[model samples]
Target chain A: MKEYKLMKGNEAIAEAAIRAGADGYFGYPITPQSEVLEYLMAQKPHERTGMVVLQAESEIAAINMVYGAACTGKKVMTSSSSPGISLKQEGISYMAGSELPCVILNVIRGGPGLGTIQPSQGDYFQAVKGGGHGDYKLFVLAPSSVQEMADFAKLGFELAFKYRNPVLILADGIIGQMMEKVQFFDQQPRITDEEIIKKYPWTTTGKTPNRERNIITSLYLEAIVEEQHNRKLQEKFKRMEEDLMFEKIECDDADYILIAYGSVARICQKSMELARANGIKAGLLRPITLYPFPSKQISGLAGKVKGILTVEMNAGQMVEDVKLAVMGKTPVAFHGRMGGMIPSPEEIVSALKNKLIGG
Target chain B: MTEEIIIAGFGGQGVLSMGKILAYSGIMQEQEVSWMPSYGPEMRGGTANVTVILSDERISSPILSKFDTAIILNQQSMDKFESAVKAGGLLLYDPHGITKHPTRKDIQIYKIDASEEAAKMGNTKIFNMIVLGAYLKVKPIVKLENVIKGLQKSLPSRHHHLIPENETGIKVGLEMAEKIN
Candidate 1:
C-alpha cells in the first residue's frame, strides 16, 4: 500500500507530475520555486519512472523543450516562477498556436522586474490574458493548497491533451514552500494513443503514423486564415468561461462580499470574520479557476449583494473581472498590497468599513 | 469543527514536528488538514514558522491570517504576530521566552514554562511537545486518539521507538495546562 508523507508544495507538484504519467520535465531553477527543480534532481525520475528530467540552458530553452516533447505526443511539462515564466511566454505562445499539448507550472513570485522570491499573485493577468501573444488562454488552474498541488495536474495534463492545448498550474511561493500530506499512487499513462489519435492523428513520431507528412506550423500565408484561427481560439475561450468552479462562503446572507482568489483568499477569510464582527455583513467568494473566472457565480451575487470588493496581492488583476460581473449594478471596489507585503485583516476590514459598508 | 493551524518557530524549537502532529491528528479526526513548514531560507534563519489550516470545509488557501489560536515559543514571535490575533483569540506562550502578555483582555492567555516542563520529563527536545500538549488541553480541537495516530503518521518508520517520549511530553503538558485552567 502507498503511504502518506509531509512534502513541501513544490516537491508535491514535481512528484504529482511524475505520477500523472508525464514523460519528461524540462525546467530552470529560480528562488522560492527552486525546490521544484531540486526535488526532481533528488527523485531521479530518469532512472526510475522512465521519465526524463532535463536541466535546460534557460527558461526559453526549457519551454521550447516542452514544445518539442509535446510534438512527439508525450506528456511534457516545464515549471518556473514569474520572471522565468515571462521568459517562457514566447515558447508558450508558439505551443498554443501550433496546438501542441503541454503543461506549464508558474509558482509565482512578486514581480514587474526580477521581483523578490516571496509569493505573490501578480501573474494572474499573465496566466489568464495570454502573456506571450496572439489571443490564447492557458487553461489555468490556480491551486491554493498543497493537496491541490498534488491533485490538480493529473486532471490538467488530461485536459491539455483533450483540447490539444497548454494547461498551467498557477501557484504561489507560499504554496511552493509549505509542506502538507500527500498520498502517493501509481496510475495509467495520462496520454493514451487512442486519445492522441482522436485529435492529432498526425503526431510527429517515427514515420509510419500517417501516409502524408504532417508539419505543425503556426504561420498563415493570408491574414484571413489567421483571423479564422483567432476566432476558433475565441470560441474555445467562451466554452471555458461557461465551465468554471469557485468556492462560495456565506454569500447568500452577505450584503457585502469579499472577492479574492489564490493565497489572497486566506487573508480575505479572516477579514470577512472581522468585518462581520464589526457590524459589516461580509462574506467571501474564491474562484478556483482563474481564467474561466467564475463570472457566472459573481453575476448571480450581483443583485443579492450591495457590492463586491476585490482583494489581491497585485495592484488589481481580478478586480477588472469583478467589475465586469457586477456590471455596475452594485459597486465593485478594490484593496490590494504588493511587493511581497501581505495585507493584514485589519487593513481589509478598514477597506470594507470605509468603502463597502460606509457607502 | 476542525481547524488547520500553522505554528512557526526556529529549528531548535520543533516547529516542523509540532506542525506534523497537528496535521496527523487533524486527518485522523476525519478533518481535511495540512501541516506546512517554512522551507528554504526561513528554515535556516534564527526564526521558523509553519501554517496549518484545519477546517470543516474544503480548505481553499493553505495560508493563514488569523488562527483560532497561536502558540508562540519565543517573545520575538509574539511581537511578530501580536497584531494577528483576533478578538477572543487564544495565545499560548512559554513563560520562559515571552513575558509580555497581550494587552488585549478579550483573548485567553496561557503562560507555561515548557522548557522547564521538558526538563522535568528528562528531555529538552520535548519542550515543543509540552507546548503542544498544553495546546490540546486548552483547545481540544482534535481528539486524543487522533493525536496518537498523527504521531504514527509523522515519525519515521525506524523512529517508532521515540514515540513513547513524545506521548509523555504531550501528557505532561495536558496535565499541567489542565491544572492551570
Candidate 2:
C-alpha cells in the first residue's frame, strides 16, 4: 500500500532517514532545522528500528560522533544549519580523507555567520567546492521540494556508500520549513553487524585471525603517500560525473535560460511561466546535484540560448559555475538576495528582462 | 484550478495550523498543496503568517508575492496584505482587534467576527476554525466533508472529541460572515 502524509521538509527527512535503515543519527539542534532533530527524538527511531538517535553536546561533538559510527560501517548521519555545518567541517574533512561513507544534511540558514534563520543558498561554495581543509569534495544534492527532501535521505546514503565519501543534502529554510504531501517508501531493515563486516572490508570492526586488522584513519605520514591518496580521491570525484542529475524545462527553443537550484529553482519555474506568458521564450535549468554539477548540460544549452540568468538566494555563488560552463558562448548574468531574502517570481522575471533580454 | 491564500495573524491565533488543515483538506480532495509559513522570531509572539497554495496543477513556488485570497486576522496583516491580493481577488478577515477595515475597491471584502463568536462559544481555540469556515463559505475550494476529514487527520486521536466543537464554530462562522461594500 502506498502511504502519503503531509509533513514539513525537516520532518520528512527525519522520517525518511529512519525508513532508509539509517543505523544512527547524531546531531545538535539549530533553527530552521532543529525540527529535524526534534522529529527524530520524538519518533524515537531507537524504539522503532533500533536506530540510535543522540543529541550531542555540540555541533563538533555530533559530527565526530557520526565520524566514529561511520567508520564502523554503520549507516550514520548528522544535520545542522549553516553555523553548525561550519563547525562540522573538520570532522567532515577527516571522514572524507579516511574514505568513510556518511550523510550530512545542511538545512541552510542565511550566513556569513549566523546572518539569519531564514533560507539562503550561501553555502553553495562550501558544499560543492569543499568547506574543510582538503582537496576532497562532498557529493552534494540540492532538493527543492519536500518530496525530494524525503527521497534524498535514501539516495544520500546510497551515493555516500557507493563513493565511500560524505554526501551533503544542501537544503534551505524554505524547503526545510514548508509542508507538503510526501509519499513515503516502505521501511528498510537496518544492516546487521555481520552484514556490515561482510559488505565493508575496510570497516573498523573487531579484528579476527582470518583477516588483517581494518585500520580507519585520515593520517598519511609520507608526503608521497598523501599525494597518492589525494589523486585517488580526485579520480573518485571525477567518476561521479556519471551520476550528475538535472532538470530542463521548456529549453528546446528557449532564447533565454534561467539557471537555479534548491528553493530558488522553484521560484525560477514560476518566472519561466511568467516569461513565456509575456512571449519572451525563457526556460529553466535546475541542477539537482551541486557537486557533480550539471556543467555539461549547461554548456550544451548555452549554445542554443542567447543569454542565461542565474537566480539564487545567495549573492551570486552558483552563478560563477554557470559562467564557467557557458564558457563565453552566451552572456551570463546573476540575480540574488542575501541575508535570507527570497526573490519573488516577478522579481526574477524583471531580472531576466533587465539583465538578459532588454539589457 | 489554483487558489493561493495567505493567512496572517498573531502567533497564538492558529494561523499556521489553519493553513495546515486547509492543506490537508486539499490533499483529501486529491489536490496538490503547499504550505509555507513565516517561521522567524516573530512566531514567538508577534505576527505569524502562512502561505497555502492548492491547485489542480503542480505548485511552482511556495513563496509568493501576491495572493488570490488574503485571510487577515489582525490589523498588521491587513496593512501588509490588503494590497497584496490580486485585483478581483477575495479579502476575508476577522474584525476582532482590527480598527481600520479593508478598503480595497477592486477586491471583494468580507468580515467574519470569529474571535467574538469563539468567545461566545466559550472556546477561543476554535477561533481559527470559525474564520476557516467563513472563508470556505465564500470560496468553497474544498468540500466540507473533506474539511472534517482534514480536521480528523490533523488533530491527534485524543483531541478528536473536539472536532464537533470545531464544526460548530465553523457553522457559526458560516452564519455570521457578512460582506460590507
Candidate 3:
C-alpha cells in the first residue's frame, strides 16, 4: 500500500529506472532531456545503490559509454533530444550490432536544424527507420501521457534486457514538463554487478582470471560470416513481430476505427466520445509499440469496422503502417496536423462524422 | 455546455497556479478539465497565463477558439484577452493594476481591487486566487471544498505554508464579487 505524491516526468523516469533494475546511466545534457540527467545526478545512485551514473562529454561519448557498460552485461540507459539523438546513431548501431541490452529516451523536438525547443514528433521516421546504421532494429515505445511516461520506463528497461537489445522511449517536451498522478513500485530489483559478470562470462572485461579470451566486434573479415550474423539478428526480430500491442477503445460496434498513437491518441479518445454521442460509432487503435508494428490487430479489425482513419502529430508516418496492416480490406485514410501542432477534438469529430456519413 | 477560462498576469500574481487549481477543482466536481500555459520562452518577467476547460463529458481539445469567461489581472492582460471572451460571457477585472476596463457593456464585468485587498491581507500575489474565487462565485461550476483540496494537492512544498492566505484571498474575492455586481 505504498503511494507517492505527484511527480514531474523526469523524476518519474529516474524512479522507474531504479525499479527496472538498470545498473547505470551514461548520458549528456540536451535540451528537453536534461531533466533525466538532472534526476540521476541529484540522487547519485552510485553512492547508495551501487548503480553508476556518469555524464559523458557528448551524446556520442555518452552512448558509447552506455555501449561499454552494456557490453559488460550491465543494464544501462541514456537520454537525448532530436539533435543529440542524431549524434548517437553510430554508437547505437554499434550496440545493436554487438547484441547489447540498453534503453534510450528521446524527448523529440522540431528538427533538421537547431529548430525550436518545443515538442514535435518529427523523429518518427528516424527512430523507426534505423537512425543508427546497419541492419539492426530497436524496440521503440511511445508514451503520450505523464502517467504512461512514468510506467513505460520499467517496461522499456525490462524488454531491452530480456531480448538483449536496445529500447527507445519516444516522448516529447509536453510529456516531459507535465506532472501527473502515478503509482510507483516499492520492491526494487536488487541486482548486483558481480552477478551480471558471472552470467555473461564471455563479456570482454579485459583478461579474465579463468576464462577463454572474449572479443566483442561487429566487423567480420569474411562476407559469409557477416551475412550469417545478420541472419541471426533478423530471425530474432521476426520473433518480436508476434509480440505487438493494440488498445481497443469502444470498438465493439464501431462504425469507424481511428488509428493513432502517443499524445495524438489521447486527443482521438475524446473525439470518439463526442462522435459516439452524435450516434457515430468511432473507436481507437493505439499502437503502443511502434517498431514491432501491430499489423495483425488492424488486420483483425478489417471486417469488424467500416473505415480506418489515422490521426497523427506528423504527416502520417504511422498511417502508412496502418495501411499495410489493413491491406485494402477496408478503406484507410489519414488526417493530421504536423510540426508542433495538435489537432483539436472538433476537427477529429468532423473527420469521423464525414467518413461515417460516407463523405 | 463546454467553456474555456483564461486568467493572465505577471508571474508572482498567482495566475498560473490558480488556473491549475480551478482546473483540478473542475475535474473533482465531475467535469472535463485541461490546464495549459504560455510557457517556453516567456517564462520569466514576461506575462504568464493559463487556459482552463470545464465540460460535462470528455474534453476533445484543450485549445481555445474563444473563452466562456475571462479574468484580467493587469491592464495589458485585460486588453489582450477581452476580445477572446465569448459574447455574453463574464469578464472580471481587478482595478488594482488594470487601468483600461473592459468596454463591452453587454458582457458582465466585476471590477475589484483584488491585489490591493490581498496586500491589505498581507500578500498581493493572491490577486489571481481572488479572481478564481470570484469566478467560482459567478460560474458556480465546482464546490468550495473541491477547490481547497485541489490547492492542497497542487501547491509545491515551498508554497504550502501560504494555504491560509490563499483561502483568505478566496473569501475576500467572493465577498467583493457579491458587492461589485
Candidate 4:
C-alpha cells in the first residue's frame, strides 16, 4: 500500500534518496535546504539501509566525496543551496568529464553573490547552461511540487546511471521549504558492486584480472584524442536534448502563452486561470527539465500563440532559451523578480497583459 | 471552493504552525492544500508569515498577492497584511500585541483578545488555537471536527496530551471573537 504523508520538500528529498537505495549522501548544510541533511541525520538512514550519510567540511569536499563514491559505480548524491552549488562546480565538472553517474540537488536561493536565503531561479543559467568549465551537460530536472521533489530524487538517479552522467535537481527555495502531501514509492535496495560491474564494466572497483585496467579521467591532453572525447560528450548532450520534458496547460486555441519552470511554473498556472477568467486567452508551458528544455514544445506553441511570456524568479535566463525555441515565429517577452523575491500571480497576469497581450 | 489565506505573526507565536494546522484540516476534509512560509533572516525573532491555500480542486499557485482571509497576530503583521485582504474579505487579529488596528473599511475586521484569553486560561501557548478558532467561527471553511483531526495530524504524538486544552481555547475564541468593522 502507498502511504501518504505531509512533508516539507527538503525532507521529502532526503527520504527519497534513502528509499532509492543510494549508496552515499555527502552534503554540507545551507539555509532553505538544510533539512535534507537534517532529516537524513535524524532518520539515521545509515543504520537502516547501510547508506553512508556524511557531513563534509565544505561543499567542495562533499562533491569530491560523491565523486569518489560514484567512481565505485555506486549510486551517490550530494545536495546544497545556490552558493554551495557554485562551490561544487569544480567537482561537478570533474564528475561530468569522467562520465561518473551521480545526483546533485541545488535548492536554490537568490544570488549573484552571497545573496538572500530566499528562493530564486537566479541559478537557471548556471544550472542549465553549465556553470562549470569545459564541454559538459547535466541532466537537470526542475520539480515544482513536494511530490516531484521526492519522485525526482529517484528519477534523477535512474537517469544518471542510464546516461553515465551527473543528474541535477534544480529546485528553488519555495519548493524546498513548502509543505505538501507526498506518497513515497516502494523502496529499492542499493545495487551491489557485482551488479554495477556487469552494467558498467569500465568502473574502478579494483582489477579483476580479466580486462584492460579502467582509467577514469577527463585529461585527454592529446589533441586528437581530446577532440574525440569532446565530440562524444556533445553527442550525449544531443541525445539528452531529445529527452525533453514539459507540461502544457490550456494551450489549445490560446492566444498568449507563458514559459516557466520550477515554482514559477506553478505561479503561471494561476495567472493563466486569471487571464482566462478575464477573457484573455492565456496558457502555460512548463519545462520540467531545464537542460533538455522543452524547446520543441515551445516551438509548437509559438505557431499557436501570439506571444510567449517567460516568467522566472531570476532576472532573465530561461527567456533566452524560449526565444531561441520560438525563433521569431512569435514574440517572446520576459518578466521576473530577482534576488529572493517571487513574482505573484497577479503580477504575472499584469505582465502577460502588458507584454504579451499589448494591454 | 477555494480559500487563500495569509497568517502572520511573530516568529515564536505559532503563526506558521497555525497555518500548517489549517492546511492539514483541509487535507483531512479531502481538499488540496499547500503551505508556504516566508523563510530566511526574517524568521529569527522577526515577523514570520505563511500562505495557505485550501481548495476543492487543484491549487494553482502557493504564492498569492491578495488573500481571501488575513489572520494577523501582531501589530507589524496587521499593518503589513491589512491592505492585502480582498474587498469584503475577512481580517482577524489578536489584540495583544497590536497597537495600530486595521483601518481598512472594505474588508471585515475582527479582534480576538486571544493572548489575554490564553493567559487567563494559564497557558499562553494556546494563543494561536484561540485565534484559529475565531477565524473558523467567522468563516468555517473547514468543520471544527476536522480542525481537531487536523490538530492531531499536525502535532507530534508527544504533544497529543495538549489537544484537550487546545479544543477549550478554540471554544473560548469562538465565543469571544467580536467583529470590529
Candidate 5:
C-alpha cells in the first residue's frame, strides 16, 4: 500500500526524488528549502537506495556537481532558494549548453540580492527568461502544493531526460514550508551504469574499445559548429513547447481572465470566486509550466475575455509574457506584491474592479 | 464544512504545533487540510502564527485575510487577530497573557484558561492541547477521539507517553472554557 503522511513541500521533493530513482542529489542548504537537504540526509537515501546525497560547499559547487552527475546519464538534482539559485545560473547555462539532463528545484524566496525568506515569484524572469547567459531555456515546472512538489520532482527528471536539457521546479516559500497530506511512491532502483550507457550513447561513461569516445562540453571554438549546436538546442526547445501545461478555471464565458502561477495562482482562484460572486465574470488561467509557457492557450483566451489581469508575487515579470501572448487582442493589466509580500484575493479583486472593469 | 483558522502566540507557546495537530486531526477525519506557519524572524520567540484550513472541498488559498476562528494565546495576538475573525466567527483565547480582551461584538468570544489548566495538570507543554480542547468545545470541528489520534500521530514515538496527559489537559479545557461577551 502507498504510504500517506503529513509532509512539508520541501521534504516531499526530497522523498519524491529518492522514490523516482534519482542517482544523486547535490545541494547547499538554504532557508524555505533547507528541509530538502535535511530530509534527504535524515532518510539516508545513500544507505537506503544507494543514491548519492552530498551537501556541497556552495550553490555553484552543488549545481556543478549536478552537472557532472547528469553528464553521465544519471538522474541528478539540486535545490536552493532564490539567491542561491542565482548563483547556480552560470552552471545551469553550462549544463544546458552541454545538453545534460538534471533537475533543479528553486524553492523561491524574495530576491534581487539576499531578500526576505518569504515566498515570492520574483524569480519568474530569471527562471523562464533564462537568467544564465545562454541561447537556451530550462523546462520550468511551477508547483503550488506539497503534493505537486512531490509529483514534480519525478516529472522534472522525466522532462529533463526527454529533451536532454535541465528542468527547474519553480516553487515559492509558501509551498516549501506549508504542510499537507501527501502520498508517496515505492522506491525505484536507480539506472545502472550499463543501462545509462545503453540509453544515452552520447554520454561520457568512459572511453570504450567498441565505440567512439563521447565529449560533453559547451565550448566549441568553431563558429559553424556552435551555430549548428544552437540550432539543435532550439529544435529541442520547439519540441518541448508542444508540452505547454496549464489549468484554466471558470473561463467558458469569463468577461475577464486572471493569469497567475505557482502560489499566486491559488490566490487567484479565490479572487475568481469573489469576482464571480460580485458578478464581475473573472476566471483564472494558471500556467503549470512557466517555460514552454502556455502562451498559445493565453492567446486563444484573449479573444474570449474583455481583458486579462496578471497576478504575481513579483513586480510584473510574467506580465510581459502574458502581454506577448495576448498580442494586443486584449488589454493585459498587471498586479504584483514584491519583497515577500503576498497579494490577497481581496487585493486582486480590487485591482480587477479598478483596473480591468473600470478601464 | 470549511473552517479557516489562525492560531497565534509567542513562538515557544506551541502555536505552530497546535495548528499542526488540528490539521492532522482534520486529515484523520478525512478532511482536506493545509497547515502554513509564519517562519523566519517572526518565529524566534516573537509572535508566531499558523494558518490551518480544514475543508470538505479542495482548499484554494492557504493564506487568508479573514478566518472562521482565531485562537489567540497572547495579548499581542489578541489585538492583531480580533479584527481578522469573520463576523459571527469564534474567537478562542487563554486568559493568562491577554491584557486587553477582544472588543468585537459581532464575533462570539470564549475564554479558556488553558495555561492555568496546564499548570494545574503539572505540565506547561500541554497548554496548547488545552487551548485546542477549548476550541473543540466551542466549535466541535472534529471528534475528540480523532483529536486524540491526531495528537498521537503528531508526536514522535518517543513522546507518545505524554498523550494521556495531553488528553487530560484537553478534558480540563473542555470543562473550564467559558463564553465571554
Candidate 6:
C-alpha cells in the first residue's frame, strides 16, 4: 500500500533508499544531511531488508566503500554535505572512469572551505561541469521537494545502472532540512546474488569458467586505449540527453523568464506569480536534471522571451549555463546570494524588473 | 485558501514540534503543507523559527520573508517577526518575557499566556500545545478533532496517553485567547 506521511527531505531520501532496494549505504555524517545517516541507523534497514548501513571513518572512505561495493554489481549509495562531497571527488572520478554504477547524494551547504551549514547552490559548476578530473560527467538530479527527494532515490539508481555511471542527487540544505507531505511507493525486494550475476554479466562475481574474467580499473597505460575508453564514455553521456527533465510554468505567454533549479526554483515560482500579478508576464523554467540540462528547451524559449533572469543561492554559477543556452538570443541576467543566504520572491521580482524588464 | 505561518521561539519550547503537528494536521485535512525551520546552531537554546505553509493549492516556496500569521513565544522572536506579519494579518504571541509588546496597528494582535498556563498544568512541555490551541481558537484553520489526530500522528505511540491532556490545553487556549487589537 502507498503510505502518506510528513517527513523531512533527508529522512525521505533515507527511507526511499531502503524501499528502493539499495544493497548498501556508506556515508559519514554532516550537518543538514546528517539525518540521512541518522534515520538509516535508527531504522536499521539491515534487519528488515538485509541491507548494509555503515558509518565510515571519513567521507573519502565512505565514497571509496561505495565504489568498492558498486564493483560487485550491487546497488550502493553514499551521501554527504559540501565539504564531505569535496573529499569524495577523487573516488567519484575513479568510479566515472571505471564505468561503475553508484548513487551519490550531496546536500550542498555553503562552500569555499566549510563556509556555513545553511543552504546554497554553489556547487552547480562542480556538479555539472565536473568537479573531479578527467573527461567525465555525472548524471546529476536536482530535487526541489521532499517527494522528489524520495522519488529520485529510485530514479538515481536506475539511471546509474542504465549507463553504468555515477549519478548525483545535487540537493541543497533547504530541501534536505524542510518537511512536507510525501507519498511513499511500495518497497522493492533486493536483488539476489544469482540475479545480480545473471542481470549484470560484466559484474566481477566470482567469474565462472564459461566466461572470461571481469576487470574493473580506471587505469589505462596505453594512450590509444585510454582514448577509446574516453570516447565510449562520451557516447554514453551524449545518449543521456534523452533523459533530460525540466518543468515549465506559464511560459506560453511569458515576456520574461526566470530560470532556476532545486530550492531556488520554488522561490522563482512565487516570483513568477508576483510578477504576473504586477502586470509583468514572467514564467519559470526549472531544470530537474542539472547535468543533462534542458538546454534545448531553454534555447527554444529564449527566442520567444524578451529576457531571462537566472536565480540561485550561490554567486552566479548556473547563469553561465543559461547564457550558453540562450546564446545571445536574449539577455540573461544573474541574481544570486552567497554564504547560505536565500533570495526572497520580492527580491527576485525586483531583480527581474531591474535586470530584465528595465525598471 | 493559503495560510503562511511563522512560529518562533527558543529550542526547548517545542517550536519545531508545534509546526510539525500543524503540518500533519493540514495533511490530515487534505491540504498541501510545507515546513521549513531555521536549523543549525540556533536550535541550541537560541532563538529558532519555523515557516509552515498550508494551502489548498500547491505551495510555491517553503521559505518566506513574510507570513499571514506570526506566533511569537520569545522577545527575540517578537522583535524579529512582529513586523514580518503581513498588513492586516494576525499576530499571536505569549507576552511572557516581552518587555515591548507588539506596536503594530495594521494587523490583528492577540495574546495567550501559554507559559503560565503550562506551569499551572504542571507540564512545561505542553506550553507549545497551549499556544497552538490559541492559534486554532483564533484561526480555526484545522478542525479540533484533526488537531488531536495530528497530535497522535506526530507523537509516538508511547505518548498517546498525553493526547487528551493536549486536547484540554487546546480548549483552555480557546477560552483564554483574547484579541488585543
Residue A238 Cα positional deviation in candidate 4, in Å, after optimal superposition: 1.0
In model 2, state the lDDT of residue A359: 57
iRMSD (Å) of candidate 2? 0.7
Model 4 chain B lowest lDDT segment of ten: B95-104
**Model 4 lDDT per residue over B1-181, tens place:** 9999999999888999999889999888888889999887878759899999999998889999899999988888887889999999999898886788788889888989898888888999999989998999999899989989999998989999999998988888888789898
RMSD of 6: 0.9
**Alpha-carbon deviation at A263 in model 3, angstroms:** 0.4
What 10-residue stretch in candidate 4 chain A is worst by lDDT? Answer: A1-10
Task: Give me the runs in candidate 2 sitting further than 4 Å from their true place.
Answer: none
Q: Which regions of candidate 1 fall more than 4 Å away from where they truly are?
A: A1-8, A40-48, A179-186, A190-199, A221-225, A273-283, B2-6, B36-44, B55-65, B82-89, B95-108, B116-123, B137-140, B143-145, B171-181
- Give a tens-digit lDDT track for model 5, residues B1-181: 9999999999788899889889889888888999999986778659899999999999899889999999999898888899999999999988896678888899999998888867777899989888988888889999999888898889999999988988887787788779998
lDDT values for all models = 0.80, 0.93, 0.77, 0.91, 0.91, 0.94
Docking class of 6: high
User: Candidate 5's residue-wise lDDT over A211-255, tens digit each?
Assistant: 988899999999999999999999998899777899989999899
DockQ of each model against the real complex? 0.34, 0.89, 0.31, 0.81, 0.78, 0.83
Interface RMSD to the true structure, each candidate: 3.3, 0.7, 3.8, 0.9, 1.0, 0.9
Which tens-of-lDDT digit does each residue in B15-35 have in candidate 3?
A: 777877876676556665666
lDDT of 6 by residue, A223-277 (tens): 9999999999999999999899999999999999999999999999998998999
Q: Per candidate, chain B TM-score? A: 0.91, 0.97, 0.89, 0.97, 0.96, 0.97
lDDT of 1 by residue, A206-237 (tens): 56554677788678879999999888877877
Candidate 6: tens digits of C-alpha lDDT, residues B18-48? 9999999999899999999998667765889
| lDDT for position A54 in model 3 | 87
* TM-score of chain B alone in model 6: 0.97
TM-score for chain A of every candidate model? Answer: 0.94, 0.99, 0.94, 0.98, 0.98, 0.99
lDDT of 1 at A317: 88
Clash number by candidate, in order:
9, 0, 0, 0, 0, 0
Error of 3 at B23 (Å): 6.4
> TM-score for all predictions?
0.86, 0.99, 0.86, 0.98, 0.98, 0.99
Residues B64-157 of candidate 2 have per-residue lDDT tens digits of: 9999999999999999999999999999998888999888899999999889888888899999999999998999999989999998999999
* DockQ of candidate 4 against the true complex: 0.81
DockQ of 6: 0.83
